[model samples]
Target: MVFQPASGYFCRALGAVLVIAATGAIAFAQLTIDADSQYRYAQSRFDSGAFDEAIVEFNRFIHFFSTDPRVPRARFQTGMAHFNTGQFQAAAAIFNQQTVNYQGLPLDNEAFFMLSRSHARKGMFEQAMLDLHNLMAIASAADTIDQARYELGWLHVDQGRWNEADQAFGQITPENQDRFQVLNLQQALALSDAIPTKNPTTAGWLSIVPGAGQLYGQRYQDALTAFLINSGLIWAAWESFDNDQYALGSVISFVGFGFYAGNIFSAVASAHKYNRDRVAEYRDLLNQRRQMPLSLVPSPGGAALCLTIDF
Candidate 1:
């Protein structure tokens, strides 16, 4: 028996089915390719220092595949992108979300650590301490704990809070402390000892004794110079008046008065500046112990980020 020709309607139905199957397969392939392609593009942007653009691409990949295993990594990098681009608040938010939303994930510790940094960058020092505490609370993450404590100590030191710095740095083992040159804690404590502080008001009052004001400000050379110049001018002015050179005496007295007045102001200024410089010296020492430096730059249409991680 011979088979009859297929119907036109039947042929058309089979063609439709084939078209649907082919279209579905292509879509699946495209999705897979897109996830990888977008991830690579995002990474390239980061590597090329195009942090703002990288954030956009990274978020695009994450938005498309929220359930993909790579999503956590994308989330972390997204925070980094914001950090590199100087959107510190945005970075802190992203990192905070990762810690709260991605519990049990490996990125939780990292997220907390980065969150602390973002908060610190925003000058939310108290909030930064909270994040640092959260990072140290991860019992299973010893590495994160060490780093968090270290950064915490430096934060305290930066503010010249020696007691707090000592407390934070004390948590580490002796070996780790030595290895990290944790001597900043020791130095800070040492600096807390009462040292002499010159009072600006007293310095100004002492100016009535000529060089006495500069002497109180611990400017011995300046005191000597001021005394010598004032005395010389006064003597010259007196001699001019004694000789009846009234014009010369007037000029000398006028110039001598300015120097005398300036000396008093200079002494007061020097004392206050000395105190300010003392605080700044401690801060500079703390800066040397910072984990790393971070930078943000404006891009063509946006901002980008760079960070030097030492811890």
Candidate 2:
């Protein structure tokens, strides 16, 4: 998921003011009343899950009471409304502001928690983890701690850091255990140990044989394709040279050389890509395991099969 700005309705509603004059002959009007009333209506609408109307009202509240002390609370509420409606970015911004302006307020921890959630929803795992860390540091509430740890583990899982995710999940106490969390951690930990093996250097393999690097990198199709093309060119070059067609042989020889060069380059690139993919896979697995209650169990050789068979 990615973060996106709020809809234009809030901005538009904030910009337009409907001023009602108390008397036709007088210019005096109920400015404060209008703002408060609009805010109250928005709150009521939000309570009923009418996010669209709530958004309209909240925008008006911000517009009318931009300097009021209640503005922070209003902003937080607006952000929650946006979140419930699936506006992740909007919710993130509101929650962030709530944290900054109402640091000592009782809702500060809640704001931080929501900020983490918004970041997670947007796939900003690093940012979400930072917020979760902060929440864990400051929040003493049992439920809050549990929620933060669970979300933190999820962020790790999203990034494929299975070990880290396992650690995070392991922090959850038995009192807070849930079936979903347990199952998720088990799956992530299993994946961490289930990836296919790969050779360290494709270059070494390619040096031994033209397309061996590609094969080592598990690119069987590419290896076969390169081998066929290069072999054909080599054969053609040899045949021309044997028939005393020096010029034709020279051209064919150069073509074969080009194929050889390309094979080497492809082999190096494949090796690098393979290594990167391997790291990413492990990292993501570790991240998922971070939220689980299970810890990493070390094996004698630092590797072990995650599956068992009954024979």
Candidate 3:
């Protein structure tokens, strides 16, 4: 049988099309299989606490399935993997991106919470506070709000902003006070009434009346410190005087005099600070009373103190 060139050419073209289609379908199947395998591997790694490995696999899954509906979940898992591994900054970045990319998504609250924690860990206190506020604003469940409020209080405490911390802690409802929330609230209340030790000049306050400034500053131990320091200097001056060392005595006297002067100044300053703090506290109480209807009348068994520390 003689082969017609035209029929042979048509056959060749048809075969080429079939080969191309088969090759494309196989590539697509292989791609799907690889994606499924990567996703499973990522999940397994996460389950085993191999966060770094999980992150790599999750990233691969995300890269392969960028347009897939499961992409958000994959990204979220990747961020969580980073968070579990203590790579908070990287986790935060991922979470932030997730929120931006998937706003109004179901995972918004989780992403916001993670971002807030990351900011807190990184010492970006103001940003953390804002994120916490965002979480509270968007939280649908009471428990979630309570948790966010508790974390917010700790963030304030970490920054030494005790008044704000107290306010945050006070938001927790009594019935929902978990051990963590209750303990943190108690700590916040204690810290609220106490002055922070950020100022080293507090030491100078003790120099004035031996322990007067420290006592005013609500640092009883610091008062003893001031007294001991002054006593030691005074004793040194007395010994110099008794030994008939006029020059040495004069030098010690001068040093003592400066310390004494500093102590007096510190005492005055500390007293001023103490009074100012007390006034502020009273003002805050008044403001609270004004804002809440419950504060209109005193309770029959005395006012319900939110949280009070004995010492």
The most accurate candidate by TM-score is: 1
Report how far residue 179 has shifted in candidate 3, in Å. Answer: 14
Q: Candidate 2: where are CA atoms >4 Å away?
A: 1-57, 65-73, 77-93, 101-107, 117-124, 183-187, 200-208, 244-250, 267-311
Decoy 2 TM-score against native: 0.61
Model 3 CA deviation exceeding 4 Å by range = 1-33, 132-206, 211-229, 238-244, 254-311
Per-residue accuracy of model 1 over 156-180 as CA lDDT, tens digit each:
8666687888788788766577756
Tell me the tens digit of each residue's lDDT in model 2 across 53-147: 88888788888778865566677678878888888898999888777744433457667877887887787878989998887777777766776
Per-candidate RMSD, Å = 9.7, 16.3, 13.4
Error of 2 at 200 (Å): 5.2
My TM-score estimates for the predictions, one after another, are: 0.64, 0.61, 0.53
| TM-score, prediction 1 | 0.64
- Model 1: which residue pairs collide? 84-304, 84-305, 85-304, 85-305
Model 3, span 163-217: residue lDDT tens: 7767777888776676344654555366445543323365454445687776767
lDDT of 1 at 291: 53
**Cα deviation of 191 in candidate 2 (Å)?**
4.2
**CA lDDT, candidate 2, residue 165:** 70
> Each candidate's lDDT (Cα)?
0.78, 0.71, 0.68
TM-score of 3: 0.53
